[model samples]
Target chain A: MKQLGLSVREDAVGNIFGRWVGSEAELGAVATGSHVDAIPFSGKYDGVVGVLGALEAISVLQRSGFQPKRSLEVIMFTSEEPTRFGISCLGSRLMAGSEELVRSLKRTVDNHNVSFVDAADSAGYKIHPDDLHNVFLNQDAYFAFIELHIEQGPILEKEGIPIGIVTAIAAPASIKVEFEGNGGHAGAVLMPARNDAGLAAAELALAVEKYVLESGSIDTVGTVGILQLHPGAINSIPSKSHLEIDVRDIDEKRRNYVIEKVHKSAIDISKIRGVELSEFKIINQDPPALSDKSVINAMEFAAKQLGLEYKLMISRAYHDSLFMAREYHQWV
Target chain B: MKQLGLSVREDAVGNIFGRWVGSEAELGAVATGSHVDAIPFSGKYDGVVGVLGALEAISVLQRSGFQPKRSLEVIMFTSEEPTRFGISCLGSRLMAGSEELVRSLKRTVDNHNVSFVDAADSAGYKIHPDDLHNVFLNQDAYFAFIELHIEQGPILEKEGIPIGIVTAIAAPASIKVEFEGNGGHAGAVLMPARNDAGLAAAELALAVEKYVLESGSIDTVGTVGILQLHPGAINSIPSKSHLEIDVRDIDEKRRNYVIEKVHKSAIDISKIRGVELSEFKIINQDPPALSDKSVINAMEFAAKQLGLEYKLMISRAYHDSLFMAREYHQWV
Candidate 1:
């Protein structure tokens, strides 16, 4: 970036900012960039595309001899996937004055024995510094935040579109449920007398899908992504079934509503099947964000100027922009 | 057995028979015994108790000088649990002119790479040597075959009975089903677009239980003993489910009726859920056995003479007596 007349700086909390240095340096800068962190087993195209896109745009502007009214800043937020700290948008959370809230969140990352704080500390991060509450760019640092990122959904590829304007960001709330029933010798237990946890669990899993479909919500989804049956033998009856469930939607109420139906079904099944059941929410993240109309319109106008076909999309995967939008109203 | 003045002999196929010299050695023996082998992770007292009970009965008869016109013999059939050879009542199967039949069954023992024959050979047993139609004592060796073994089911324990006289042995007809469907990221896949094999398999399992219960056959029972989901993950929709089903009853027609109903259910579910479904019967041991009426009556009379409470029972577990009864009409 320095070769293109851009100066790079790192914040106290380690957010990276590259400045193109417009003549009017006093005015707040226009920011366009994304994080560089990734989830496990994922391709490198996720956040890297956005960060590199900003660099290329700056290069094109320099070659074209464009003079801006305000400086253009490329900001790379840290740990946007939260795979290491166990919280998404870790840098954005701090810069948005959520340092205290994020500090209180407890998690285990990579199935490691250490807590989230220990891992973050080992990676050279601290929730709060003595001098400042918001260690990186605060809510008022940028006039507008526009990120260029590769769409992670099937829509763009299936529709043959090259560009997209994100309309809203869908966040996740996760929970786990455990069902207990009597285990027996698979053959020795008569069908009528047997209380099989595996059967009950399978029934509950189906019930989850049934009620979700029955709700008739288009954007809503519920998943029993992880299931473990106790004493999983070819010939032995399962005594316990453990599940990790994830429900996500752009609308938090809709997500919670579907989860309520799931809880009700579990209760009914437990009573009918004489199986003991228990469950609790492990994650409760609320305040889903809608894209700023002005920021979206700007992206659409840019696409129109370039004569590129584009679609209005939603980010089912939570991103740093969602946290940034909490304080900075002009988020893309 | 040596303390009781009994001589023991092992056939070429390793069946053990202990005999006390009778006044007339030419008369065929009244044989009472059972195999001492057990299934994996089972109680040691299963067939062992029966073998020891015969030995104790012989000791008592010797103490009382109870010499009969027919000689008394104690027989121990090998591989009765069938875990090692994958064929139940293996010794009896060979002795009842089923040496050819036993040779046809394929099996893997102890999760090893070798076939049942290889395992048996490694343990020192050869099949069909010249000048011998059968390696062990054939059906003609015993005049009356009586076996004393423990009931595997909970009937006696639940009914508060001290003794049980098994009247019939139920045989199992086992089948395996595999369902294949498209897998996807659970969150990204829309509700209507999913063809989840997990849900299909769960529905089919429930269908199995439903059909059996609705059939209203008290003696009938079916089990989905083995279930395996492919790429089982909390965040991924399941693509395949494999199951091993066991349906059993003394009445072959009724058992087959339930199994046929289950197959019909699988077909309906496959069509409804748009999953690839296939199934095949792995075991079809047919021609169920009923204990000899005279033998059951004699056991009942013996229970009455001892003033011990007893009940007529049906054996859900296949036993050596069932195979022996195929040839020895007087077998109990």
Candidate 2:
């Protein structure tokens, strides 16, 4: 921040902001940045690449001795990974007036009974209690915002595309389903009398695969990553089984439809086999985020101008851009 | 034993022999006995019943002032269940001059490095080392051998029949199979490109059920008692799985044929799915041991004379009689 002659500002929620005030400082700032925080064991490329890329872009712009019409800012948001406090983009959400929701949803970090308020109070921002509500950013002052992030999927690498202008981003909505049956000695129980939970789980897994494949395999993907059977001994007929399922697609309605179908089939199979089934939604996040058309066009135009290969792709994994695009921007 | 006018003698291999000398003591002793040892947690009826039944029969004869044409003897064989010492009919096999096989098969009992010979020597049997060979019972010296054992199956109970005269004994021929496959992150891997070991294992389990059911279900039975998977995690595809398989039938040829079919199908599936498969014969034990026809006829005749409902059925399990008939009296 000092090297670029930028002024530093901290939000009440601890979001760091660096402002390089142009002659038209009164005008909206053209923001270019990404979240600095990362998930555990994945700090190398996930958000770091985007962070460095944004800083380098800023440096390049500065060294060119060209001043932008609008002021420029590089902001690093806090807690982009939900692993720490359950919900991601805590700083952005707090500024966007979702502070109460974040507070209500959060219990404690590290199970230490440290409330979000308590954490923010001691986050070293040193903001007065009255200033906590002043964390909201002046969105009207920004003409455009862009986040450079890593592609978490194999799409770009497989296609040999150097740059990707994402049009949509996919987010997960998950469910946990369990089937209960009566277990018995495998040999002692006759085939007809057996209420095998493993069989029920296997059939459910296959059904999930079938439904997902049938519902436009390219658009939606459903997976039973965890299929746990109770009393998993071979000699003992399985008594209970459960699965942790994840389904994702760019279209929220399509994903919901597939989820409905999966739930229906599981229910039908459980009823047919006399196994008790129960399902609960663990996560019901927002629909997929579509990128700003003007911003996407700008990226495409720039790539074309540079004679670079690029793919107009959909992000199959979540990024900090998802939260950034919660509201419309003139040039994002 | 002294009160009952029975002479107690100990074999070199620790077999307890109680003899009631008759006028024809010069002739071979009419042996009537069973093993006193049983598998863990089972002592109510197994060998105890047979041992008591033989002694009761002898007591009844003594009470009736009966003079046997041949000398009568009741012997309690050792370590018949095979769970301990890892050998069935240890005493009987030793008496049959299978001392070398017994010694070779013997291991530390009770997790202690105690040898079988050491156990026998310490078992209160005061015998000269030179007389160890004398422990081999002369089959020609006995005209008959009878062992009355409790039916260890539900055949008699299910049929409501009081008596079950076992005509054959069934033992399992078991094998262990392992399937190896490539494991990867569940979410990152596409369905078509992924080599899921859990899926392979699940399909193999279903194949086992299918193959066993296809074979003559009434005669043959196959079971997978243990299914172990490596790095069992929800987010990771299973990399390896193993199963402990037990396949058994009365006819050795039929059992072997079924085993061969199972092995072939597993191999074929492994090849088709690109999963590495390996199977080894952990136990290639012999098939059912048919009882001596003369003894079966005598049992049937006695049940017939008593006007009782009896089933002269083949034993779908093993007993001391299987080893006793190794090389014994003309009637067993």
Candidate 3:
């Protein structure tokens, strides 16, 4: 509550930080929780739900006269959409002790002109890489970290569950495959003589689909979401094809199996179609984070007291918690 | 021959006509012909061989001081490559009374800035709908038309044949098919939920190849020379695919069968892929032409007199003679 001598700080990039001073014994200590700034129109609950839910929980604790072991802080990060700077979870990723991703984000969408430094500066935010440490200092003082989110998929709703207790967030790997073939006049050429890179790519794509379907890895799956053919003329043979493969699983081993099959299928298709195929692993092996059992027990105990029906479920989507959990392994 | 006082006249497009003066007793004239342009980097023998061969035959007759019952004329038409003007045998087609084909040729390659009038002017030719008859004049003057052309295929050389008398030339039907689908983020979407236009196109192309091979028409064949995926991106689904189908046969019915199968297959693929697909028949049908047996006999007689061996063979490629033969159907 503002009556507790609360104050707020606003950064140049519109990053807002609000604090509620704890008792004198807990002063100079910190506990942090917050959400991102924006979401698309369709994603009404994404970041907004997390920030509002945390604030509501804090208010309830205040109303009940409950006190924490350490100073409790609620924070909202900025530019989490990555829509503006091409860097999703920019605020959290930076707070988790890595600025390396910022370098790569600078070259996003094939544009190298806008560096991460420029993006920050353009948004009127200071580019002090050293100051990033301040964001993590509170992590050590926090007694616990928690995030409340809407179940984006149908699993919880289908089961008629009102709330979900998070267990593990599934990891994903994104792969890009490109095939190169000779471009030539289509009419005068014979099929037997063609390298036909597009055909090769198609065969591989279909094989990937069939492989995933037949593999029956209950915990893993693969999908082809992007396909491109180059020098696409109605009368000229296609010279190149690019395809994207997205495979994910809570079980890393099964995900690896799907990826290996995809690569093998691509190689076989290239050989059969007489074209050269190459594979590029863009996002490799982000392992799933298993939630802390102690936190789950505490949440279940609280749910019982509140008479709220909840179920344990796996997080199929990635979130900022995955990175924060990396810093506090037991919290995950 | 040059010594025989031959007079020449040319149209605006440089289609040359040569007439040799003869005695009044010879009421009709015999025409020997061919075009003189080559395909890009083609062998010199392709077009020039036909013209030079006919000229050599006439030269030998002139040296022998032989006189025929009819006056003989040699002619050379222009723009046979379809490279500069995008239409093959334009001069001959015009001369053979195909005004519709001329109009269709003008419509080729849509969105092209060059108008038909501008294209004619740029090519040093003028097309006036009223003056179309001028190009097709003097139709009854020809007693017979004999054309000499090199075999485009290697069948004659492989069989060690010395010469071949023309029988019929094969006709080809070229068709263009395009499939449109929704393009969206690939990773965030599922296959069953996608319309995947490019995938539908790929299936149709492969089906065409399979159907043509299975049609059991020994001489009937089909090819997909061009396959294009539009707005091709590595992580975005394809929204459109354009395909070119070239089906050919000595028999018109068989070619039509292949074309029909292609259309049916495309429709079926569109339905299966959950995308909208449509086709544009860019090039329709042109029936094969049968050369005149009387003219073949005359050529054979001349070859026999020169102690040369010859065999009758069908032409698998198109030539100006095809249209010319149609024009002089009675004599051809």
True contacts kept of 2: 0.12
Off by over 4 Å in 1: A1-154, A162-165, A185-188, A226-228, A233-237, A278-308, A317-332, B1-150, B280-282, B319-332
Q: How well does candidate 2 score on lDDT at residue A277?
A: 85
Candidate 1 docking classification: acceptable
Model 1 chain B — which ten-residue stretch has the worst lDDT? B127-136
TM-score, structure 3 vs. true: 0.58
Sorted by DockQ (best first), the order is 1, 3, 2
Q: Give native contacts recovered, as a fraction, per prediction.
A: 0.35, 0.12, 0.15
Model 3, which residues run further than 4 Å from truth?
A: A1-209, A212-332, B1-89, B102-115, B118-154, B160-164, B298-311, B330-332
Ranking by lDDT: 1, 2, 3
Q: Model 3, range B114-144, lDDT digits (tens) per residue?
A: 7655677676667664555566645676666
Q: Report the candidate with higher TM-score, 1 versus 2.
A: 1
Q: Cα RMSD (Å) per model?
A: 7.4, 11.0, 9.9
Interface RMSD of candidate 3? Answer: 5.8
Clash number for each model: 3, 1, 4
Angstrom error at residue A11, model 3: 25
1 against 3, candidate with superior lDDT: 1
* Residue A77 displacement in candidate 2 (angstroms): 8.1
Expressed as tens digits, the lDDT of each residue in B187-235 for candidate 2 is 4445566555555556665666666667655656555544555545433
Which ranking of candidates, highest TM-score first? 1, 3, 2
